[model samples]
Each structure stands twice: as structure tokens, then as C-alpha cells.
Target chain A: MTDKQRENLKNRIAVVAAWGVALIFFFPIFWMVLTSFKTEGQAIAVPPLLVFEPTLENYIEIQERTNYVKFAWNSVITSFGGTAVALLIAIPSAYAMAFNPTHRTKDILMWMLSTKMLPAVGVLMPIYFLAQKAGLFDTKLVLVIIYAMVNLPIVMLILFNYFREIPKEILEASRMDGTSTYNEIRQIVMPLAWGGIASTALLSIILCWNEAFWSIVLTTTEASTLTAFVASFQAPEGLFWAKVSAVSTLACAPIVIFGWLAQKQLVQGLTFGAVK
Target chain B: MNRTLVRLLQAPSIILLLLWMIVPLSMTLYFSTIRYNLLYPEREGFIGLENYRFFWTDAAFFPALMNTLVLVGSVLIITVVLGLAISVLIDRPFRGRGIVRVMLISPFFIMPTVSALVWKNMMMDPTTGLFAAMWNAMGWQPIEWLQDMPLFSIILMVSWQWTPFAILIFMTSLQSQDQEQKEAATLDGAGFWSQFYNLTLPHMARPISIVILIQMIFHLSIFAEIFVTTSGGPGVQSTNLTYLIYIQSQQAFDVGVASAGGVFAIILANIVAIFLIRAVGKTLTV
Candidate 1:
């Protein structure tokens, strides 16, 4: 083959390989989506059908049997609620630490991170008992608070990294202009760091949305999120593969789309800026 | 400029985190040393390390510890190795790269419970699952995944969900790499493997460590997958320490023993945490 033809061949091979790898990585999700459209019998059939008449029966049955919308709504409210509170608590402190660093700042940040490292189960019983005693068990409010606390260290660290990137001269110039710290933040820092703040919120929201452990432990039915709702299908006797797949697809769809959009921020935020 | 104002701005977060950390943890520590079974509240009293002794002596404790380590270790190795290969493969631009990236990263967004259930019933079920179907198509008996190799099964599901994370981080780090060095190495007649070893691997050290540490923290407490799929069962074969503690407190209603197990988990986590904090701390300062 000529050199030009060999180059073309190599590019084609790369394209094919990339597609093959992507497809394999994506196969389980595709299978779940496909299974969601299959009839119950086809869903669990030996030599599962790749070419079957698609049906909406599973979706319809799931809707009739359980309040899928309710669980989804709870997920939305708690995740957003948690992200908002986390940002509110995290931003100011992050700003202070980033711009007005003290000798103890690093220690304090490390301490906060250590708190996150404390395994959740270590505190599970007390939190559970306390929630019951306070009559706050299985409430969205409690979940929101716990989620915020759970995500606070991450939010603060990411926001701190973002705020640190804002050129110091901008803040210094404002200070020389006799602008107050509050005005400095409101007028300049917030606007400049807006993208980072937004990304922090998005990342935390996704984390909260997919958080399973605390949600399953803390909420039984009244305030169950999509994670807990999906776990409810763990009943071993049921042959409701299609219905479960439908619920699984529904539970993961919105966040997966959101995750794709926020992939860049997710990398930066999740690694605590270690990668970037 | 008053430093008090800066301290004030930071105090709310500090105080809240302090309370959140101190209250429950101290309570857990307190409970660990005493007898506090929910089923026998009247029998509650200071037991002085007896709960810890009971937890340590249990046959499942050592297995659970081993399982936790194996699960974390296997997943770490799988994700890092695969992530490195895939990141390098896609590092050079290819057709439809954006869509390919999305496809690759989709699994990380899946809820653990959903992923577990999907793997258990739809994919791994030997009777009529996808793997079974594939095996039967090829005229082979399907491997019973959860029944025979429960821990490995859980490891596989968790690894699938997290490999995307490692890929994302490694891919991002690769974008910021020094291309001149790679070009120079190529000019020096170094092959792809040599270039990767001398140029890419060293450059990716920080990200690789970050991925391993972060994934370790999450994997150490893996619960929902076990809860949904194996229930850490077939006689504690798949039981990690986290699941064991869940069984102790939630099922057996022995809060004291569970708390003791929790303390053990705390220590295990701290051993990892100290190293992570130091590594990350160095990065932050620099």
C-alpha cells in the first residue's frame, strides 16, 4: 500500500477500535435500556432476545405499582437542597481561606478532609438514634442536612481551589479602592468565580443524587429517593426484570445526562484539583 | 483589615463541622466500650472492651477484613490499569471523541443499587441472565457469579462504576501533559512503550495516586451493592467490614459490638487517610 493509503487505514482502525471500546463500556446500560422495553418473559429468557417486539408494558406497570415520580421528586429536592446548603456554608469559608490565609488554614482544611474520611457507619447508629429521638427520621429535611454535611468538605475544597485562582490583584485593587470585603466578594470574586461555583453545585448535586448508603439507611418509604426506590426491588422472588430495568433506567437517566454535560467540572472538582 | 472578620466568616463552617464530627463519633466511641443492645435496653451498662473482644473473636471479622482489603485492592488495580490503557488509547484524537467519552463515563453516574441489581439479575444470573445466554449460545455452562464468586462479583460491579472515574482523572491529566517531551522522546527513537514509561507514567503519578486514594475511601464503605445483590451472604463470603457492622447493628441489634466494629473500620480508614491527607496536603501547598 502507498503511504497515504496506509495513513488512511490506520485512522480507520483507530476509529473502529475507539468505537468498539466505547460500545463495550456502554453495553450494560444499553442492555438495561433494551431490557426495559422487553416483555417480562423476554427479559429473563435464556438466550435473551436481541430482536423482539418492544413493549411499554414495563413502564406502565412500574408507574401503576409504585410512585416513581414521588421518588424522583424526592431525589431532586434533596440533592438540590443539599447542594445549596453546602455551597452556602462552604463558599464564604472557602473564600476566607483562599484569600485570607492564616498559618492554621492548611491544618483546618486537612481537618475538614479527615472528617470526610471518617467512615459513615462509625457514626451511623448515633445519627440514626438521634434522628429517631428528634422525630426527624425519614424526613427530607434531615436527609438534606446530612447530605450537606457529607459533601461540605469537598465543596469547600473545590471552591477554595477555584477562589485561589482569581488573581489577587483584583481583590487587592478593590481593597485599595476602599471596597468592603462583602462588596469585593459580591462585585468581583463571585462574578469571576461563577463558573467554578456552578460546577461545585453540579458535582455535589450528582453525588447526592446517587448517594445510596445513607438514603437507604435513613429513609424507609416516606422520603425515599430514587436510590432507595430502586433498592426496593431487591426482593429475590420476583421475576420483574423488565420492571426493575425500567425503574433503573429512570433513576439513572437524568443524572447520567447531567454527568455528561458536567464531565469537565466533575474531573476537576472530584479530584480536589489534584489532577488539574 | 480585621482578622476577626475573616475568622468570623470561617467560624460557621468550622463550628458546624466540629459538631458534626465530634458528637456522633464520641457517642460511637462511648458506645463501643459498653453494652448497648437495642433488644435489651435494660441490660445496658459499661462493658469495658468486652464488645471489642466479641467483635474481634467472631469468625466473620477476619474474613470481612480480608474481603474489604481484597475488594479495595482488586478494584484499585483494575481501574488504574484499565484507566491508563484507555486514557492513552483515546488521548490521541479519534472520530466522535466527545460521544465516546460520554459513553465511557456513563457508568460512574449509575446509582450503586441499580448497578448491583442490573449486574445480579440481568447480567450475572446463571439461569437466564445475559452471561448465561451468551454462554449457552457458545454451548458452555454459565458461571454462577454471585453464588460461587460473590466477592469478585461485587468487585466487578464496583470496578465498572469506578473505572470511569480513574479514566476521567487520568484523561484530564493527560491533556495537561508536556507534549514537547513526548516529541523529543519520539525524535530520540523511543518507541510507544518507552515513551509511555519515561514520559506518560511519571507525569501521571499524582493523578494515579489521587484516583487510588479517593476510590479506596469510597470502596472501603461499599454497602449498597452488597445489600442489593449478595446481602454479604453464602455464609459471609462476600461480607466486608461495613456489611458486617450493618448486620451487627441492624440485624443482630447489638449496637455495642457494631460500634466496636465501627471503631475498627475507623482505624482502617484512618490508616489510609493519613497517607492520603499527606499526599494531598503536599500537593495543595505546592
Candidate 2:
């Protein structure tokens, strides 16, 4: 074959291979959606039937049997609440670190990141006991607090990077004009770094929404998020394939949709500082 | 007023994090040395390393430790290698690439618990899952995934969720690669594989390390997937250190033993963190 033909063949092969990998990655999600429309018997049938009359029974049963709205509400409340609180704390901290040079700033940032490495299980006992003692167990407020703390490192780091990108000249110019620190941050920094702050807030909300470890263990009923709701399907007496898929689909749908819409910003935020 | 107010504004966050870290960690250290089983509340007392001894001697301890390593190692290897390949392929311009990228990255956004449940019930179920369905259609026996090989199944599920993360990082790094070098290599008659091995691989070393370290940190604490899918499973086949601690404290109500186990996990994670920071730091300084 000519060199041109060889190049064409290689490109074709690459495309085909990419398609195959994509299919493998996507199969589980496709299967979940497919199973959600099957009956319990069809779901668990030996030799697993692929072609069957699809039904909405699982979805109907899910809504009727479980309080889907309540779990979703808990998720929204905790995720948004946590993100709001984290942003409140992180913005000022990141602003200080980015603009104010201190010998301890890098150490503080590293310390915060290191704290994230400490296993949540290591601290689970004390948190559990404290929650019980404080009457904060299974409350959205507790989840909000924990989620904010848990995700604080990444929030601070991302916001710090964003803050660093803004030209110091603008802040210095404001300083020369005798602008107060509050007005400087409020009017200048916030407006300039709006994109970064928004993306950081979105990323934190996603993390809080998907947090399973604490949501499952700390909350029983009142504060149980969608994660706990889906986990409750794992009964000791054999798996409920159809119903579980239905519940899983329901739990993941909102975040999945939100993630799809915010794909560009999410990817950028996640890869922050890596490329640089 | 200006400087004082600015300093005051940063105090709350600093104080909150300090409290968040110190209070729980000190409490854990206190619990580790005491006899504090929730079931036998009246039996509480200072045990003086007895719980640590029991935890260290338990048959499950070694297995859980090894399982934790295996889970982190396997997921990191698979995700990084596969992520590199996929990211490179999709990094170039192509028709419909945007849609494909969205689909590929979608799995990373799904909640761990939901992903585990979906995999367990709809994709890996021995009797009626998609894998079983496809196998049966092809005249093959359906393998019980989670039951037969619980750790492997959880590894696969976790890997599926996280590979996109590695891909995202790799793709970002790939975009920053110098185009002139690739063009020059092409002119020099270097084969694609040779150029990639010599150029692309070198460019990706830092990102590859970051991906490995980040994934290891997250994977070591994997609880949602295992809990939802197998609940530590048919035996203790799938119980990693985190799940082991969970069962001990939550199910068995052995708070002292669980606290000791938690300390063990912390030490292991710290070792990984130190090594990772040193490695990443060397690259950054270079």
C-alpha cells in the first residue's frame, strides 16, 4: 500500500477502536435504562431476555412505594446549602492567599489538601458521636457542614488559581485610589473572577450531591439523600433488579443532566492547575 | 481598619477548618484507647492498646489491607493506561467528537452508590443482567460477577466511574503539547508509535502521576460501591479496610476496634501521600 493508504487505514482503525471503547464505557448506563423498563420477572429471568414488552411498572412502583421527592429534596438542600457555605468561606480565604503574600500560605494550602487525604472513616466515630450528642444526626444542616469541610480543599485550590489569574494591577490601582478592601473585593475581584467562582460553586454542589459515605452512615430517614435512597434497595433477600435500576436511574438523572449541561465548565474546573 | 478588617474576614474559614480537623481527630484518638462499644455502653473504660492489639491480630486485618492495596493499584493502572489512549485518540479533531466526549465523560458524574447499584442489578446480575443476557444468547454460561468475584467486580465498577477523570486530565495535558515538535517528528520520518512513546509519554508523566495519586487517595476510601453492591459480600472476600471498619463500628458496634482500624488506614494513606507529594514536587521543581 502507498503511504497515503497506510495513513488512511490507520485513521480508520483509530476511529473504530475509539467507537468500541466508547460503547464499552456506555454499556452499563444503557443497560440500567433498559432494565428500568422491564418487569421484575423479566428483570431476573434466567438467560435474561433482551427483547420484552417494556413497562413503566418499575417507575410507577418506585414513585408509589418510595418518597422520591423527599430524597431529592434532601439532596438539593444539602448540596446547594453546602456549596453556598463553602463558597462563603473559600472566597475570602482564597482571595487572601492569592493577593496577600505570606510565608505560611503555601503550607496552609498543602495542609488543607493533606487533610483531605485523611480517611473519612478515621474521623467517622467522633463525628458520629458528636452528631448524636449535639442532636445533629440525620439533619440536612449536619450534612451541609460536613460536605463543605470535606470539599474545602479543592474549592480553595481552584478559587486560588482563578484569583491568581486576575491582574494584580487592577487591585493595586484600586488601592492607589484609596478604595477600601471590602469595596475592592466586592466590586472588583468578584466581578472579574465571576466565572471561576461560579464553576467552583457548581463543582462543589456536584460533589456534595454525590457524597455517599456520610449520607449513608449519618442519616437514617429524615436526612437521607438520594444515595441513601438507592442504597436502601440492597435488601438481604436477593436483589430487586428492576426496582433497583429504576431507583438508580431516578437518583442519577438530575446530576447527569446537570453535568451534561455544564460539561465544559466542570471539565475546566477539574483540570484546574494541571495543564498550567 | 482596612488591614484589620481584611484579616478578620479570613478568620472564620481558618477557624472552621481547624475545628473540623482537630475535634474529630482528637476524639478518634481518645476512642481508639478506650473500650467503647455502642452495644455495651456500660462497659466503657480505658483499654490501653487492647483494642489495637485485637484489631492487629484479627484474621480480617491483613486481607482487608491487601484488598485495599489491590483495589487502588488495579483501578489506578487501568484508568491511567486506558485514559491515555482514549484521550489521545479523542484529542484530535473529528466529526461528532463533541457528542462522543460527552458520552464518555458522563459516567464520572453519576453518584457512586447509584453507579454501584446500577452495575450490580442491571449490568452484572448473574441471572438477568445485560452481561448474563449477552452470554446466554451466545450459548455461554452466565457468571455470577459480584458473588463469585466481589472485589474484582467492585474494582471494575469503580474503574468505570473514574477512568473518565483520568481521561479528562490527560486530555487537558494533551492539548498543551507543542504542535511544532509533532510536525518536526513527522518530517523526520518517526513512526507514530515511536513519536508517541518518545514525546507524548514524556509530556504526560506529571499528569499520569497526578492521576495515579489522586485516584489512589479516593480509591483507598471506597465505601459506597462495595457497600451497595456486595455489602462486603459472600464471605469477607470484598472487604477493604474502609468497609471492614464500617462493619466493625456500624454492624458489630465495636467502636474501639474500628477506631484502631481507622488509624491503620490513616497511616497507610499518609505513606502514599508523602511519596506522591515528593514525586510530584520533584517534577514541578524540574
Candidate 3:
């Protein structure tokens, strides 16, 4: 056999092995989605049924029983709402930092990041007490505000990096034409940096959606996101297998789809350009 | 834009972050020094270091601390090692590799509570679980994972979620590697193992540390998984610092001691954060 045959054979082996690893890594999720389609009894079958009559009974049952829509709506609202708020606050902040650098700019950026380092557990009590006092506890607005704050630093950083990528000449030229700051942002910055902002928003939304620590601890039923909703399954029973799987599937599907779409850009957003 | 206008644009974020950082944190410090309870809000007074001492001396403190260390340490090792191996396996061009990468990274996007519950109910449940069925198929008894090894169970769940993160980071780093050198090495009779040890490992050094540090900051405070799967117990076996603090604040309703626990957590996290921030700081430009 020639060397080409040997190399092609090796590549085939690698692809097969890679597929095996991928399947193993992905099995639990595949199992969860599969179980979501199973009836409760089928979900917990003695041998864990691989081939069964698929059903939407579990999904229907979850919605009827727990109003899964409410929790999912809350998740949707908070994730999108939080991203909107973070972007509103971060866009200008990042815009300034990107265009108008000073000696303190890096220090200011570092200081903002240091805020992220403050452990959430450390700050949970005060926030909890304060929220209760302010009558904001377990409200979607509170979740939105808190999520915005928690993700503000990274969102700003990602935007800052993206904003910096827009050539300084365009903004300066706009300034010379007497375009106001607001218009400059709305016209020059937003249009030019649309891709970055979208990805940053995607990144922020994903973070807010999967934020278990705050969502789990800070909220109960009225404001509970899907993370909190699923935590209700903590002490679940065998009967809950299909329901929990259904809820879990619904909870993660949107973000996972969004993540796969944003998969390429998220690396730079997540690492804050550090990995490159 | 004038500097003043620029400052105005920047003010909201800086101020928001400032208040976010300082307000609750200072309150936590104050709460730690005082005697306070949620149930007895009317009776509060400065107790100096008593709350700290009480929190430190709690029966579960040492075990929770050890559990925190073990959980973080073991998860890091598992994710990093497995992540390296998996990334290398999938590194060479393969058919449908994009889909493979997407599948592998899907777990990272799953919320912790969901992942934990799925693992607990469908994957780890002794009799009705997938693992049990597999165990039975092989003629063995299924271990009660969350019951018998709660900490390990939590570690496994977290590693499953985070290994994708490590893989993603490593894969991006691997893309930039000098393939010409690899080909040169290959022609020089260098085997895959030697190439990996010398080329890939050295190339991945920076990203590996970034993975470890970032994962450390995250794993140190893992809560939802333990909360959902084990509730930090079958005993206090799976309880970590964050859960211990959660119990103190939410369950035990001991605000003073919980604040102290929070302070301990803050201190512990900052020790890691100082290093991580320095690493992240390098990327910032004025």
C-alpha cells in the first residue's frame, strides 16, 4: 500500500475515534432530550428504553402542572431584558473607553473587572436583605437589574474591544461634521459596530440565561427563571423523570441554539480577547 | 467628544459597578461584625469578631472547606486532562468535526440546575437510571451515585459542563499553532506522541493556565449542581463553602454567621482573582 492509503486510513480512524468521544460527551444531553419524549413510565423503564413510542405527553403535563411557560417566560424576559439593560449601560461606557483613552482608562477597566471578582456569595445577603426591604424580591425587574449589573463588566469589555476595532477616522470625521455624540453613537458607532454589539448581546443573554447562582438564590416562584424552575425538581421522584427532563430540555434549548449560532465569536467575547 | 462628555457617557457603568461592588460588600462586612438574625431583626448589636469565630468553629466548616478544595481541584484535573485528550483527538481534521465540536460544547450552555437534575434523576438514579441499566446489562450493581459519592457526583457534573470550555479554548489556541513545524517534525521521524508532548503541550501552556484559572474561579463557587443533586449532603459530604454560606443565610437564617462565611468566601475568591485579574489585565489597552 502507498503512503496515501495509510494516511487516509489513519484519518478515518481519527474521525471514528473523535465521533466516539463526541457521542460519549454528548450522551447525557441526548439522553435528556430523548427522555423528554418518553412517557413517565417509559422514561423510567427498568432498562431505560432506547426505542419507544415517542410522545409529547410529558411536555404537555409539565406545562399543565407547573405553568412551565411562566418560568420560561421569566427566563426569556430576564435574559433578553438583562442583555438590553447591560448594552444600554455598556455601549456608551465602552464607546468612551474605546475612543477616548486616558492614563486611567486601563485602571478604570481593571477596577470594573475587580467588581466581578467580588464573590456573589459574599454579596448575596446584603442584596437579599436590601431587595426585601425595597420590595423588589422575586420580581422580574429585580432579576433584570441584577443580571444586568453582574454581566455589565464583561459586556462592556467585549463591546470596548469591538468598538476599538472600528477605525478612529470615521468617528473623528463624524465629529468634524458636527455630528452630536448621540447621533455619532446611533449612526457611526452602531452601524459600524453592529456585529460586535450583536455578539456581545448574544454573549450577555447566554450568561443571564444560565446564571444559576443568582437566579436560584434570589428568586422564588413569581420571578423564578427556568434555572429556578428546574431547581424545583431537586427533591423530585421517579414520576418526575419525564417532567424534569421536559422542563430541562425547554430550559436549555434556546440558549444552546443561540450558543451554537454565536459559537465562533463567543470565544473572543468570553475570554475578553485574552485567549488570542 | 469632549472629555467631559466622554466622562458622562462612562459615568453610569462606573458608578453602577462602584455601588454594586461597595454597597453590599460593606454591608456584609458590617453584618459580619454584628449579631443579627433574620428571625430576630429587632435584636442586633455589634459583636466584634464573635460571628467570625462562630463561623470558623462550626462543626461543618473544615469539611466544607476541604470539600470546596477537593471539588475544585478534582474538577480542574478532570476537565483539563480530559479536555486536552479530547481536543487532541478531535484536533486532526475529521469528517463532521464542526458538528462534533458543537455537540461537545452543548453541555456548557445547559443551565446548572437542569444539568444537575438530569444527572441525578436520569443518569445517576440507582435503579431507574441509565447508569443502572448499563450496570445491570453488564451484570453489576448500580452505585447510588449522589447517595454514595455526593461530592464526586457533583464534580462529575461540573466537569462535564466545563470540559467543553477547556476544549473550546484549547481548540482555538491549537488553530494558531505552526503546522509547518509539525510537518517538519513529522518528516523528521517524530511520532504523534512525541509531537504532542513537545509541540502541542508547549503551545497550549498559556491557554491551559487560562483554562485552569478561569475554571478555578467558577468551580470554587459551584452551587446549583450540589443544590439540585445532593443538597450538599448524604451527610455534609458534598457541602462546599458557597453552600455552607447559603445554608447559613437562607436555611439557618443566621445572618451574622452567614456574613462571616461570605467574607471568608470573598477572601478565598480574591486570592484566586488577584492572579486571574493580573492575567486578564495584560489584554487591556489604554
Candidate No. with top lDDT: 1
User: What DockQ does candidate 3 score?
Assistant: 0.82
**Per-residue lDDT of A211-234 in model 1, one digit per residue for the tens?**
998899999989999999999889
Kindly give the number of clashing pairs for every candidate.
0, 0, 0
Per-residue alpha-carbon lDDT of candidate 1 for residues B148-187, written as tens digits (9 for 90 to 100): 9999999999989999998889989999999998999878
State in Å the error of residue B127, model 2: 1.3
Question: In candidate 2 chain B, where is summed lDDT lowest over 10 consecutive residues?
Answer: B277-286
Task: Give the least accurate 10-residue stretch of model 1 chain A, judged by summed lDDT.
Answer: A267-276
Give lDDT tens digits, candidate 2, residues A53-158. Answer: 9999989987888788799899999999998988999898888878884677766766776777789999889899899999999999999999999888778877
Looking at model 3, the pairs that clash are none
Task: Report the CAPRI category for model 3.
Answer: high
Residue A99, model 3, lDDT:
92
The lDDT per prediction is 0.91, 0.84, 0.88
**lDDT of candidate 3 over A1-276, digit per residue (tens):** 897799889888888888988898899999999999988888878978899999999888887878789988998999999999999999888999899999988888877877877888999899998988999988999889998998898898888888889999988888889999889889888998999989989999999999988888778879999898888777654457877888888889999999999976788767766786
